[model samples]
Target: MTDGSIQQTRLPTRTVVLHIGRHKTGSSSIQATLRHNQAQLLQRGVLVPKNLPPNLSGFFSHVFSRAPEALKFNVERGHGRQQAQKHGNRLLERLAHELEAFTGNRIVLSGEEACALHPDEVAQVRDRLGPVLAPAGQQVDFRVLLYTRDPVAYASSAMQQNIKKNVKLLEDHKPVVLRKAPGWYQRTHAAWAGVFGADAVEFRSFETACAAPGGLIGDFLTAAGIPPEGIEPQRANDSIADEIAGFLSSSHVPKLPPDQRGLWSAGFDLSTADQEILFAIRGSKGGLLTASEQAGLWDAVAADMRFIEREFGITYGAAQTAGAVPFGPVFMDDLKAALPRLSPPVRRGLLAYLRDRSAPGDPGQLQPEGI
Candidate 1:
């Protein structure tokens, strides 16, 4: 049946939860779970809007982005400001329509890109979106949820993610991540808290949340006022394997910069077996930032680490030295086993990468296995 034909409905006062992500912090996992469990969530009076994708970054960015032309979404569409403005207007209709049809008493909107919105833009979101989303004669409470991790770790993982998606990030010839971790956190905190009121903002440690009872999804559900019962947890957007990241750090680039970078294509191929091997090595590497870089990251972010502790009541523990550790044995063993199975193209690429690494920080390089 058509949406128009379906009976329109109204519900009680709603809490519109906006989970703004500070990326690399399990946002993908939460979005995936919510997207896949839409029907189940709706049954319990939570609307994960059908009109929109699970990640609302595109939606949010179009509305608040100061530079629409630079947005990956708009750039991909060949959309300049005029087109982006037109697109944002189109989203409003969809937003209103979704809210008009929503029977649930709560809404959960997520987008990692929203983490960077300015305070004024956040208020713009409130002013513009609140009325369209509120059910008739019911109050709409806006709550912002943000999950953060240790500065060093967050940057390390984020850098690896950049390289995985866009090999060309290597062009900068700088540290894969810059020393901006501290400012990144403070800005995100200010953007949300400055408008929403500190009381309306919820901050959780990503590592802690993932380690808790039902893991990240469960923790998020509880934070969003949903019962965790019977909702299966999810995992998504696994970072490139540690060994792979380490390999890239040494072999491909002169330097890896923390600033944003991307690519249109990888210029390489990964067959099913190669893809499987990539999946298998995910947790086995870390400390992608070299020793000097890791220390610099911590030094830069240390003051804010204390600020976050005092202000948000969050604390990050010690981090490992960069470039000192070998990619985990698990990565070594798994790749050793999977090497024979990789497609010739991927196998050749791996062998070439292994042969040309510029540094010797890792002792467990696959040459030991005679690949």
Candidate 2:
């Protein structure tokens, strides 16, 4: 009986879903899913632009292209946002043309680094999209979606990631210096709300979203107004096991490229007992924060947790009350139990490491090179 039932209907409405990530919040999985399901999304009248980089996080650099002053000096030097904007603008213009031609109702773009931009820089993004989208006779709905994580957990994970990338946090004795203390979520949320209007900005807890029926991928699909019934939620850029991550993060270990490092993670065929050791190591919180720092971090983020609970209607379990030593008796027990199954050099290293720990005043003894 509807008009579309008798004849083909050109979708007139278009929605722009902007996903700004606070990093380490499963943004990769969501991006990978969107990239993988582009065809399906198109069929459903959703346009996930093919012109954008395969990893949508690359779009963050594009947003930053015109706002060089806003980029923090320490981290933004190499992102090449200025040069990238030229390429991105061309894509955006092309996307505008495509949006006019395509019979789709939705467009999705995502980037974690976009959340790093100041409010003024984010306004530039809105300015770019405005003229293009405004020309459409149909209504334009622009929305911003942000996934927020527990500050303590986010900081711990980010620290581990930095170390994995060979930042030498431990070696430099400045591991926690760069990490923002608490209130980051509030500040960032305010900025986004200010730019997009309060109603247009939606906040979703990363923990809750990831734990939803279809995990992060499904959660994001649902958020983008797409159905999640038949999609696979594959994790991308998965973190390595704690023991493996620990080994790579050790001060003396040489840094390897990400792909090569991933190979190391894949190559380890851990047994059940070995898994127990790895689990214990992981439980140690990536060995990144000292106990006092960990406790204080939770305390600092407590207010944000309350705000998240009240504002987002999501409540998480209380943060850990105390910090744990990076390695513990469980690690030692599992390591000892699994030693015979390990390779010769690894066995030698583990044995030597244990021996050195037991003897006092033996700081530099038998620290195996190829562990």
Highest-lDDT candidate:
1
Model 2 scores what on Cα lDDT? 0.63
Clashing pairs in 2: none
Clashing pairs in 1: 175-256, 175-257, 176-256, 176-257, 176-258, 177-258, 178-258, 242-285, 291-322
Query: Which segments of candidate 2 are over 4 A away from where they belong?
Result: 1-11, 64-85, 97-100, 133-135, 167-179, 254-287, 316-318, 321-371
Candidate 2: residue 212 Cα off by (Å)? 2.5
In candidate 1, what residue range of length 10 has the lowest lDDT sum?
A: 252-261
* Tens-digit per-residue lDDT, 1-371, candidate 1: 76765434434568999999979998899999999899899889889888888899988988777676787777877888998988887887888887776777788999988988888889888878888888556678899999988876777677677657645333232353573465677777778888878889888889888888788898899999999998987788888765575544443323324443234543334444556665566444456666777677778888778877887788986667565444455656777777778666566666666556524666446464544
Instruction: Please list the C-alpha lDDT of all candidates, in the order they appear.
Output: 0.74, 0.63
Residue range with the least summed lDDT across 10 consecutive positions in model 2: 261-270
